[model samples]
Target chain A: MINYWIAGIYPRNAKLIESTRLYDKTLKEQFKKEKSRLLKIQSDNKLDFISDPLIDWDDNLRPFTNSLRGIERGPLTRYYENNTFYRQPIIKSKIGTSGNILKNSICFDLFNKKSKVKIDILDPFTFYDLSANEFYKSEEEAVNAFAGIIKKELISIKNNVKLIQFNAPSLARVVERDRLNMVKKAIENIVRGIDTKTCLNLWGSDISNTFEEFQEFPTDIIGIDFTSTRVDRFDKIKMKKGLACGLIDAKNTKMEKSADVIRELRNIKNVFNPESISITSSWDFEFIPESFADRKLQIMKQIKEKSKMMKL
Target chain B: MKKFPLATQEIGSIRKPRWLVKLLQDKNVSDEVKEEARSDVALLNLKLFEDIGLDVIYDGEARRVEMYEYSIRRIEGLQLAGKIRSWDNKYYNKGRCTKKVKYTGPYHVDEFLFVKENANRMIKLPITGAYTLADWSYNEAYKSKEDFTIDLARKVIRPLIKDLVKTGADFIQIDEPAATTHPDEMQLVVDSFNESIKGINAKFGIHICYSEDYSNMYPEVLEMKNHQYELEFANRDSWNKGINHSNRNGYESFLKTFREYGEKKEIGLGVLDVHVDEIESPELVRDRILYAVKMTDNPNLVHVNPDCGLRTRSRETSFAKLKNMVIGTEMAKKKLQL
Candidate 1:
């Protein structure tokens, strides 16, 4: 069971960050900084799993922004929460990767081998949806191209990674049935040749509508955000594989008590039993302050310890 | 009948001069050095507005960074939480409220006072709206998003408006680019917008854009005490491949919404596109304004401005755009015989 790993970017420790290097740092330096920060956070909390920290691609197009050339920066638009804004990458030319995207970041050692270091990639659907496609004829074409590109990257680094999580909030956001299938096909295309344990983390919309399809998804694990979706709906869907229960609230700063989290996980256990269960945040930890984020992780660790004693 | 037919206004935030941006970026500079640099450019920004013959002008938000973050740092009880991704890979330094938000005096008053003292023409104050600040921020103190927004409006925003109005601000424009981002939350925006302007003695207006559905805010938007609706149109214009050449007609969809719901209110028609580098000709601006006048069936109800703020554009482009807007409005005034 992989319990209590963080998903998405960890908030930066403000005391350690230099504002001048925000956009000036080289890719190698950024990776070193991220690993160091994650290691510090892990040691501080005594966490089991190594997290990628998502600090590497804080302001660049993740999983695809290999270089700064051939991409135009779109105007800053409001994120769903309205507090943060991302400048979307406009694909001005053919999208391709020149090298291994996650080589420098992932650490392989005795402690890291004992527990997998989690790395996140923007799912093909979201990459296509957020992009201004000037080259592709339609969004479907763009998705297909992106899937092939992502599949190549995944296969190249399949051994180095312990878990490959696809950030697919777009799949949950799609309303039309046909569009949903296209996104699913795109996901299927991206994960075709990968042997790493795969997890599809869906949020920002209800999962009940596509619960049956998600259960049959060709991946090792499935993550459902309990913050945005109702837990009662999960009773009807049976999990045949690993389940990543997003128990931590990502959007708000308020932390849930360990007892409350344990109770919720116990209730989830009463439903369809899976091969394994993992605990994580509902979404990105970047939404909250760093101190609060550390507290949230500590609460998750507490839940992990309490769950062990309870023996669900 | 109206104070000025085809009134020319420059939306808040002309681009920062390169030297000014450099001065702000340098850490070695003392506080006095940066303040001097800011004050000089602010006066220059105001002088540019006067030179271009703008009817209503602002100091271009010279003292601020962006719309939301600058005002947020000044308010009481809110703290910089962490950076969060808005989309793709772009991130912003976001904030969270630790306690009940309070008006910690005025943030933009000094900037406004400088503009008010210098500007020879009518000046309008542009402030980030309550709903936008609430919607963009992390809500920790309130149980519901609506509750947080309402408290922000009543406590932080209303008092700011009251202060600005008390300081002889005749016109106040609240910029809410995040207004219609969520269709369901438009009610929160409308209700809180009304709450923000309550008991304020000034001619109020709202700026909403980059949203597809302005209609959702309407009927409820009509309920607000504001007088003008400044919306982006030139950015959405479809190009017409005419017999001779091509031209941009941004107001094609502009009239469709205004005709249905904007019968009683004034419209600040955006005739220039700030997202692009192509300077709009006076003829194109005149054509867009004419289209608005024809479609809305009221020439007096239309005021001319850019689609959005010029913060993204170069100073040269912004100045030329504003100059063309004034000239185009003059042409429209002559043509309409208003």
Candidate 2:
């Protein structure tokens, strides 16, 4: 059988929205109470990966709420006040604990033994680039600390998960040739410590050199960002395993047709034949509106059908 | 008498000469229009600078459409596909493939010659940095931005800087606004700066703005694991609408990170925010300068400037902003006893 895999870019909107609300509260007591509720929901649902809900919802409240004061020429204030902006006090308690939240929610229903879909969890890079703090003198030290946390987290989920991909989008921006070498070293250090099946996610307008730098790493899968870079360039790079073909355009609001997507996929097939192939986007689907996201999902479903029919 | 007098000259636009244009064009243009509209306009720009009594005068980049665009025009094997519509609705031409071309004319030498000949003042040679050129273009030929940027630095930008030195240009400004946008890529930016000035005899400077999310400039700072300041500094009240949270109060952090770059080179700190139309006061400018000085600890190395290119603002706002910047620099000098 031609092995085919489909992975949704991790950190869905519902979880992200819930996490943002939990991060808004000042009181630790309220935060704990909300955390339990959100965790309970996630536990019931069974999410593969989750993050510490750290986005401040209150920070977004002004721009969102002020836009509702009849001064703007857009949507109604009541819809924004009630629906668009989520600021419930109970929700504020469970922020950043999305993995537990997903484990406790109705999503767990989708994780039964009979489920054919394998879940992949994506973790954001802990300390690739950051400012030196009072607690940490250098970013390398901070990254090492984060790597320890990531190691613990990955060990906990390795039993059930199929893949644990680390999103190191920061690596793409390294301008210096030597610094690019350093970024690769950091990625290798983090990945070597993880005791699970893992992949590296890369994004940027330019990826030609990034792929070459990362070729030295021990990742099982190599994800290419076709959103910005051309597909023809992928043929030049030598790869060993699966190619996470980002065929979908995530940045634009307009949905892409399956025919156009299939054309791009067919072009990839001509070059490197891997053990398995999967379809994905260059970045998160949630960056766009919900309606656009729905259409994108629908398009992916259609692409899956076409992939089966045109089995290589 | 003005001590250490600075001179200025206008580099002619980077366009094909009239004879070349005449040979290539399908339709012919009148000789008078080519000489008057194109050549005289370039000459007039240089003359205007000479009249202003400025030490270093330039043709204000009259020959080129955009700095990045002009650089790409020299490189071959790139297809001008379509335009990428920016968030602000401006469209920039996107390149599809990477092809190599012969380096025929000197990138900035023609402009240098024009300035040297016409202007009595010392000329300032401005060239787009390798990082900016690589960041702005579509990298169809190279594997990554870093590789393309390094290649540009080694093959094109470095050699061009050397040529400027040979021609006796006094000062060279490597314009690098993209440096702030990708801080993780700062090593590449720094490498390019080093490559450009390597074995150069002239004074070198880097111009950067502060309006965008400068957190990326110090990837080490952004990767700080703790959320202690995230709660206090990243709150809603602290946020300004339409501005990235990292841009809200990142200047202090930006300065701290910039200290790594302070060992050598004078940094043109964009004290005034160019995006907003509001005119900043000398007091505010002084505060900005003082902050930079404290972080850098070298008053001689800090130069007051507007965030980026002033083309975006109105003439009135631009003038007011520059005047305020001069005042702010003076105030900072007084406060710091420099």
Candidate 3:
């Protein structure tokens, strides 16, 4: 039986706020109550990774300070207001490298009673890519350490989770054709013993170089980004593993039609009928509005209906 | 004489005038402080241009931060996280920054606005492309860099470009120095540029530098289907005695691919090297421009500019380089008169 999967861009402030309100009651109580009701609607939709209802106190939410030795003062919060000389900090916590606030936000969503969908964590590679390296000596060391920590945490939460896909968006940055071999090797090392089924989310731009550089790996599935890279290039790549075709554009707020999505899938089906082909979002939909999330779910449902008709 | 507009890639020395440094520090300082800062750099930039005898000018990006640092401040929903060390020993922040669909402030345009108002000549507004912004930023918030880039193009950058075009700007240059980092990301960069320039009727130019590897250039050229053969012999395998076959192979098909990009936009061909401190002779610059002109069918669209910004070089070295470049352009224009 073909298993259908739905993926959207990772949740941002709106999703975080909703998840936080459900977990916290002190926000005027009314906003929290309203957020709970909204989350219930999301729960009824069978969305993946319910907003975690429990708030973790271990997460750090304080403004970044330069008290840490050897670390430069990160960009001021108002730096984004105009052109300035500050670099923003990569806030990570014991739970994750993205800092306490994001980790708590993700955790809050993960344990949210209303969320019934499978949970996928943003991969450690992307986090390490965003991390300030005054602490670590090299990218490999940072990634390995971060992955180890994530693996330990996943062990505790693996039972309730349906699937834990790792987002490796930074994989696109390795441009040296030969460096991809090292990347694949690194990925293999990080994911070697994890129990949960993992998917390596790769951007379309990375696929051309990746195919030329690292041909095959032991991962269960490979997520292809269709929105960023041209769909035509997929015809040239040869994959031995299952293909997670990202047919939906997760960045733009413009809603795509179910027919258009099915058309994109049909094009992929013609190229390679893998062991299993799952349709997903090209990237995270959080950059867009909350309504776009609803549109994404609707698109997933349409894909499911169309996939059922195809009987692949 | 060939009309080569004056431009500088990243230069090294940042010895700011004491008064200007003090003015940047004072928040309550009057418009006079800001104007003085703008004028001081404008005078320096204009002096460099005058000495070089070039038509177009820039204030050398003196009053701003690095491209990524400047943009990071304007994007909302992201916080200052921590720092990452670059290969050059500089520490950069590691945060979930996005060029995605939000605008906290005007960003580089505001900086350019000051430059344009202060400059005596038709100023060139340089903004980092969404692709570079997305490529360099942490993609944790979004699904992929492309997704983040497209969102950035559609939401933050496109709107900003439209606003920039409305500002009566003559030329808008999108700097894609990171184009060589990930060649596959070139299409997204192109798309973002196309989207950003959709409604604007301004003269658009792209500045790419330090892409000696040639691997990044091939994919982009092939994708765009442009035929321009302005190859840099210094970066060839012969330069290193034993040809690094991989680097050699990467550039083998570059000539055919470059032709494709040359067809669309005015190629601001980087005939002058930005990384090296050794000053190139005007004759060599003329030869490079002439070679580029011969390679592309439409030599008229070619504009001689630096390979990248001159912010990384010292004031004297950068001025000398610009002077040579202007002289070369003048000679090339004379030799290849339409």
The digit string of per-residue lDDT tens for model 1 on B1-338 reads 24565788977888898888888999999999999899999999888888889988988889988787887899887877765554434345677877889899977777888888989988888999998888777777888889889999999999998888877888889998788888777778889989999877788889987665466666667667778888887776643422111243445554666687646678898888887798888877887887777777787789899988898788999999899988988888888887
lDDT of 3 by residue, B61-93 (tens): 666656566666667744444333231113344
Give the winner by lDDT: 2 or 3. 3
Once superposed on the true structure, which residue ranges of model 3 sit more than 4 Å away at CA? Answer: A1-312, B1-35, B91-95, B98-100, B108-114, B212-255, B260-264
lDDT of 2 by residue, B91-118 (tens): 3443433644224446777767776787
**Tens digits of per-residue lDDT for model 1, A64-160:** 5545244576554444434455566677877776546655434443134555566777788877777667777788888887787778777777777
Q: C-alpha displacement of B334 in model 3, angstroms? A: 3.5
Candidate 1: residue A235 Cα off by (Å):
3.7
Between which residue pairs do clashes occur in model 1? A82-B136, A83-B136, B237-B250
Per-residue lDDT, model 1, residue A207, is: 85
* Model 1: chain B TM-score relative to the native chain B: 0.93
- Give the CAPRI class of candidate 3: incorrect
Q: Which window of ten consecutive residues has the lowest lDDT sum in model 2 chain A?
A: A74-83
Q: Select the stronger candidate by DockQ from 2 and 3.
A: 2
Cα miss at A221, model 2 (Å)?
18
Model 2 alpha-carbon drift over 4 Å, by segment: A1-309, B1-57, B117-122, B143-147, B180-184, B210-250, B257-264, B331-338
DockQ each: 0.32, 0.03, 0.02
